[model samples]
Target: METTALSQDEVLSLIVSQLAAYGFSQLAQTVAEVTGAMVELAPSSRLSELLYLGKEQDESEELEPTEFPTEEDQDEPMEGSTDSYSKYLDFDIETKPIPRPFPDYTQLYYTQHKGPCRCAAFSADGKYAATGSHDTSLKVLDVAKMKNRSGDAGDKPVIRTLYDHVATVNDLSFHPNGLVLASCSDDQSIKLFDLSKPGVKRAFRYLQDTHIVRSICFHPSGDFILAGTDDNSVRIYDVKTFQCYTTPPTTADLHRGGITQVRYSSTGALFATSSADGSVKVWDGVSGKCVRSIENAHAGAPVSSVRVSRNGKYVLSAGRDSFIKLWDVGSGRELVRYEGAMHSRESLQAAFTHNEDFVLMGDENSYTVLCWDTRTGALVKKIQGMLLFIIQLRW
Candidate 1:
């Protein structure tokens, strides 16, 4: 028969008590909406009480949620999603599942060589993988049988031995045509080997005066080779003419600090360089002008590797700070900063998957190679091995 009006404090207390019973997560959603509405109605009143209540509730409910999809569920399509092409909305596409317990890498295979391997490359056809180790030997593994879409462990790859380098081989690149293999080393030279040739004796070596070649890459057209060295410059070599053109970066008065890695853009018109000076530099492959420089890009650590997305729109850099930075290549602005243990150490090398949907990074710890979803920054797959380096096979 009687109605009593509750004071503002009483109303707030009752709301908070109910939210506490429902749990902090649900309370958070409710409070967010209520706060938004409250701001619109009365901007002066501070939601301090509600904010404190939410904080206390969150502290009490500290355990993380367990409603995660199983590995099997990850492979299946959503139930209500239509099979028609038009039903494929932007958010409807299934995301790669996150790894459980993270990925533990162990040595899958290792061979005793003369020195430490500085680089590795997979054949363009995906039939073989070559490693240039510190042992001064080039080892090729027959990955033909190991080429499974699921990446599950199977038969071990057959190993072929090629001993040539007197010093650590720092870089290895396979030509796009699949017939020639190129390698650079601390010995200050780049060697081209013809797989069609019979043995180690049949391989032809190209000697360069540049010492400590840190990185080497083959152009998309396979007509030229790009090599980055400790000399603080990048050299472009014409494979046929055996002539080399050097790009000396004088804009910043230095080539960052010993160009650690170099890559040719997918379009072949541009290239990216990652240096120990904590910078990522983009240069015109033809004119050699430093178009964009992201200085202090990865502060407190060296920029170990840089990769351009297959679409040439995104540039991803991994650094010693254990951070992977995603940048808009066109505007030269950072888009995302992913900081986690998976990327939390020196990511010595990185490669983009065939679809450019994921990036695989090789870390110094355990020689672990991890795959990250380019869009979501989620861990996709991990390959275990003591890697000298990891590279995606490009066909």
Candidate 2:
């Protein structure tokens, strides 16, 4: 049997193929040994040329290059890269441990109001949570005790207040300071309540004669309040004066149909509104000018809710079309679309988590709150129960 020695090109091709198959660490070790011998014999030879040839061979075999951070690069992480060494590259996969089965949430004491509680909000301290029900009442629950007594078989939440509204309360929000609570109702009014005061008289109320108030939110700085109504316009009210600072019909032509959702950007420079006109509009919060308008944003369905991420980079909207659309705020371009079993033509609500990395959404028939990965549009987790609506605990 005659043993034949491999040619330089053949040897280089084999090494490159192995490198592409096995990855960088092993390839580096193998190349070091071969290159050392070649250097000893021909010190002036171009090692770079040899490496280039290896890369060509690897490419011809349709092998992807291994992405490994160098020592210096490891010390200074790349921009937008995760700090975890395990996630040095986006392609790296990390599997989470399977979650333990949920306890019987049915045992958790929850108040069943007369009508559908379509919206909810929590105070800044997370001590209180308020739900707006179609029964024409707003129920405030002591959330702190609810968590502590969750293990108690029959522990019920202490009702903080049973504030009354002439019509169904459609949306509610706690001021950033946690001292004030605001509720919007079908009666076409936005009510402000001072929780610090003991009696109902201390709770102040404000009225708007526009059509039913569909959604309401406070500016991040708590200086102003924004509300969307069925009158096809958005109203901005000054918090201190308790008067309309910027009246509706300012940009009335922007939304031809009823406005369903309005949200202020985290930076307080811009705000977004979604409407039944099949459009979403971004507006300058200070100048009261329309910045950009997205037409047919949710097709023929009215956008039921709109939320801006904490970082002010993305906006999320859910509508009757059973789809959630994500948009880049700066360019006003649609980035991603997410569809889930819970999204429906019926009014659905969506909000960004405190970290802005996850989105929570709910609908009338949904028995669980859907959590989605904002970056990938993937379903991350589900909070099981008959969820009416969800709001981030105000901070």
Candidate 3:
């Protein structure tokens, strides 16, 4: 931590610097309240971070080959708030010593998919990219070969496309070993792709009657896969036996709503789910027992997405009500609320940056992604020009 004397201007500068460089709005606000010095998002801290940053890739190592470049330079900085709507920002400008030795940013784009991609994932080794799309198809790409992931041509060749589903594939996850890809669809099927093979093909497919497989996740140990269906129950499937447990995670007598999303903790010790009722449940990852449940979590608004933090300490949920709330994993109580970007009536996605400094989310109506300071709920940036109605973003 960079410490400074309370009387110096560096106090204010330090507070604002970390807030922009990181997402420590709590520190910025605390210092601002103590000193009465207005703080704001620093202009110089973000341009390089946003336009240049990516998972560092070696020339030899590959995350499944793609046409995308590892880095790029931006002619201008990303657009931030200037209108009256941006009331949380510090309106007045102040000078502070610029931080030296900014990190270089490289950008990559992958655009071979035929339609709007509803879901996507990178292989555990970062070697391949898989997408579930509106065309009711799934495409797997070689990220290493493309060099750059972005492509304007929708017809760009992919390893293969799987087309067995009749409806949109809502979510997809990779086995821990990256040997297989699992997907769940609104068409009422849970399918697994054998990535260990050179070509794309289904290794297993489980058909369901009335329930749509809305979401699915793999255990960190690669033992089993968890599926959440529209029928309001969670099912576990054994990878070896290819059989789904006859029992649901909760009692069959419980009247739960359709599960909108599911995520496992970093250790795979616990997993959590969000339902159509905006409620949430935490279950033991191994035993598949519902240990904690939050009812009416967002006051009846359907949860669009749910994620456990990279540190496994916090759980975040994005809702149809147009807000993202952070929760204490232990207490199950809401801690912070992030808002101000458009997500109303859409299943916009939310997740933490790799380092967990900021909370990132996308808006369907705005066609942009917004960054919020995680420690305190402050809109840091509104980013555009990279994606369209981004429903999928992963590190």
Candidate 4:
């Protein structure tokens, strides 16, 4: 010790080695980088022999009591403490005031898929949502955490990303129970995903169809699924048995063109279908038989989308002719027609707003949304600069 002195580099290296031995590799690296020192630890055999050779008989270490309270004592809150967050303990959604934007604000926006998003469906309770894209992927999102236009709050709305379809995903439907989501794709496949189960990477039930499925909807009871295909066929599949029942072939009544959209009435007593054949048909929900048909519904233009009113007394249909016709479900007659929306090629969706007071449809040509008075059939407002290729709409 009297004859030997350690160099600065040796001292730094020794400090780094000790720090690494105590499992502080990050701190050791930082020291090496800052001091320009080489960090080489002692050989394993020699270090082990030197460190543990005389420590075999050492007594086990015991902890001495400190001023801090034990775990049991800390269970209770400290004296004079106040619960500043007590107001946030429980939230009453009904009492909360809804935010109303003057010009329109996007409640949710996501760009995870590679291709265009084709369809979206909200759960019955509006707490969850599922979207399908042309990129052959489905994303399940948490509605409660949907981000705003600012992209600051609730940033990560998507909770799960699912990839099972080989081709483009066309439609998505959430069961009435809201726990299961069904999706149809142009790949000629249908898949069911149960959202209650965690870490689900694949569908729980997979169905293969002969033709490409364009639309899918779950029955109000969640016991059956109705699908419309590119083959101009409508079919129902039993959820429990996985048995598919095709509509009886009636050459005179069967749709001649591709089935674009299918939906069930609010009462589940009747279901509606819009086809590329330029017709809309309403069928009995129980017997699965066509009851009413509006032939040449769009004046030879393909009926793009159809939706049953909440009362089940009316049906709202959109066609490539750029008209939204309100039809009487009982008389099978057109009630009122709302125009001024440009839709020529894509299957654009039309929807009814609160209490069926106003009907709305997206214009594929101008990327605008047109709202009209349901009773007067007069255009009310035009929301411009909306997204394109809107295939579905719900109140």
Which candidate wins on TM-score? 4
Residue 284 miss distance in model 3 (angstroms): 1.4
Deviation (Å) of 383 in candidate 2: 4.2
Put down candidate 2 lDDT per residue, 17-74, tens digits, no spaces: 4332222335545674766534221111133335545674574477434588432332
The collision pairs in model 2 are: 320-345
Sort by lDDT, best first. 4, 3, 2, 1
What are the lDDT figures for the candidates, one per model? 0.64, 0.66, 0.67, 0.75
Task: For candidate 1, write residues 1-395 as lDDT tens digits.
Answer: 57677566555544544333222335534664764423121111123334544674575477454589543233333455333112111222434332223233344454455555556788777778887777777877777544433445545564456766677777788898877888888888888887766565335758575568878889877878888887677788888898888776575735646888888865455788888788888876656677788888878578878887643556888887877878887688876665443444433666655445456676555555666765567766767654444432232
Residue 213 of model 3 has an lDDT of 81
When 3 and 4 are scored with lDDT, the better candidate is: 4
Residue 376 displacement (Å), model 2: 1.1
Task: Report the lDDT tens digits of candidate 4 across residue range 258-295.
Answer: 89999987546678999999999998775567888999
CA RMSD per model (angstroms): 19.0, 18.8, 14.2, 25.7
Candidate 3, residue 25: Cα displacement in angstroms equals 42
